[model samples]
Target: MNSEEGRSRPAWGYQALVSLPARTSTPTRELGRRALFALGLLVITVGLVYFDRGAYQDNNADHVVSLVDAIYYATVTITTTGYGDITPVATHARIINAILITPMRILFLVLLVGTTLEVLANEGRRVFRDARWRKRMRNHIVVVGYGTKGRAAVKTLEKNNCNPAQVVIIDGRPSAISDANIGGYAAIEGDATRRDILRRAEISKAREVIITLDRDDSAILVTLTVRQLNPSAHVVVAVREQDNATLIRQSGADAVVTSSDAVGRLLGLSAVSPNLGTVIEDLLSSGDGLEVSERQVTADEVGKSPGEVMGERVVAVVRNKTLRRFYDPTVARLETGDQLVVVRRSDQAAAPLPSGGERREFGGRRGR
Candidate 1:
């Protein structure tokens, strides 16, 4: 294989180290409860045999029933695997066997077999639900890696009116999957870099994919796999190293966020001027001081300059999927399909732009 091909394939050692969460055979509480109940039943059956020792006899080797013999007899009876080695000689012993022992045996069977049946039933239901979900999934977002970045991205999407049901989380860690489940998101417990796992998540039909894997190589592999599976899906990835951003984008990611670089820049800004950093942070945060939002240009605002728009402070305009700054010559006249990326106070509601192409007072306080 060529050097590029070797670099693209996942390493065998890395795959071995990736700990995919195991499929649950049964819920923890249900398994514990059933085990305790079975133990209790065994103890009760043994106790019955001990209290009625004199009434029973062992048919093998001419020995009288002792504690050990009673335990053995109870085990055999509850399991319904009677060996014909123990017999009740007295009438009361037979009566006890009919009324008490039989019920305990039934209870033991229910406790043991019922748990297995429940596990099987749950597996069946999960399979059916997964199949149905995959069939109906479209325009859905697949979030690979439920780490801090992934969680924050999903939260932002949810805040913007995205449905939780439409977001699917994929993570290799059991804890991450548990967290996703607790947050009411459907999750797949497996490595996102694997083609089979992405296929299971129905990446081909996904509308968008957000990759937040810790390692740059894993993120790049996932981006390549997702792009191959769905050529049209918009892939956004987070990279820890700025050097890897270009490589990730080349692997077919639509957008690359260099987290480390951004954080470093913010820290530098804060060191130089604290107020400037604070203002930028406020704009980045949602429902805090100031919020950044993107909305389509209103019909009345078409053919008007960004400076003439009211309500929000238009910082940039997105036309034909390309960003143009407010002062850019291209954005001097807003078009019908243009989108405005603006900043406003968290408490303010956006109002329709006036039809006369006249400027109005910005409703939001510009900065803290």
Candidate 2:
């Protein structure tokens, strides 16, 4: 059994659901351009009719054509809804109608209906692409929540070279999904505990599942559902209470993080010794501090001891899918296929350690 099998799980619960603003697409610049073009065409057509007033007549009145009448005539003619209340009488007016007015009407139609057609075409393309993406999605990671812990875990995964495109987010809140979409991750908005929602996320084909639901009960249910759907996939969960850890493990969680107890211990350590707390924090953080990384053992170091490896501090070794401490007698002599879990500077490039070299300590100021 794995060392994490007996660890306590946290018992955090989801808070009351809050309504978030629905995502709305703003008017595109193309639509605005089309509108302005159509407006200009209307204005020019009205002006032409107004100036050539002597060539036209209003059937309803004996009075000369007015600006309102000119605009009304232009509107109806361009819309192809000719009311027959206005007519061009002179030969020049008839010729101009065939040449200029007809083309203007065609242009107006294109501008007005073109936008609607483009919108529909783009929507069709989007649907087709989404369908294709779903079919090709496999060995991806599904994140059940977008809360603080979930977000942090995602960031860490991304920092460690995991592809953001392969990460799927499932959250109940629309705002959380919107945020995930904005960050370029695929997101499904629904209750994660539901089987249908998990199915929609392609849970069966996923390689890993991260459950960060707020409620311990919800987390357990989701874990059970996910385990049933994908028995082989690794499942990691966070709970707030220690007592519920066993339940989560029984539910088939491969790893459990007891957030409350971890935080409490950190606080106590910080109060007792500030430097020790800072060192632990540095080890947990990435980018500007020490980070924990795992890599396969190099061929040249196949028969060497972990203590003989220069530069990095090897904490543990993974061999044949089992973890062994660096100090373990069985692990003392490094093997060809063993994976080393070591602590190194976050910004340092990974390279094979030189033989018979001394260990180097990395500190914030020194690394900088």
Best by TM-score: 1
Per-prediction TM-score: 0.73, 0.68
Instruction: For candidate 1, write residues 25-133 as lDDT tens digits.
Output: 4466667778788989899989988888988888775767888998999999999999988988899999999999999899888878876578668878988998899
lDDT of 2 by residue, 160-275 (tens): 56899899999999878988999889999999989999999999999999999889999999999999999999999999998999999999999999999888888899899988
Instruction: Report, for every candidate in turn, its global Cα lDDT versus the true structure.
Output: 0.85, 0.85
lDDT score, candidate 2, position 188: 95
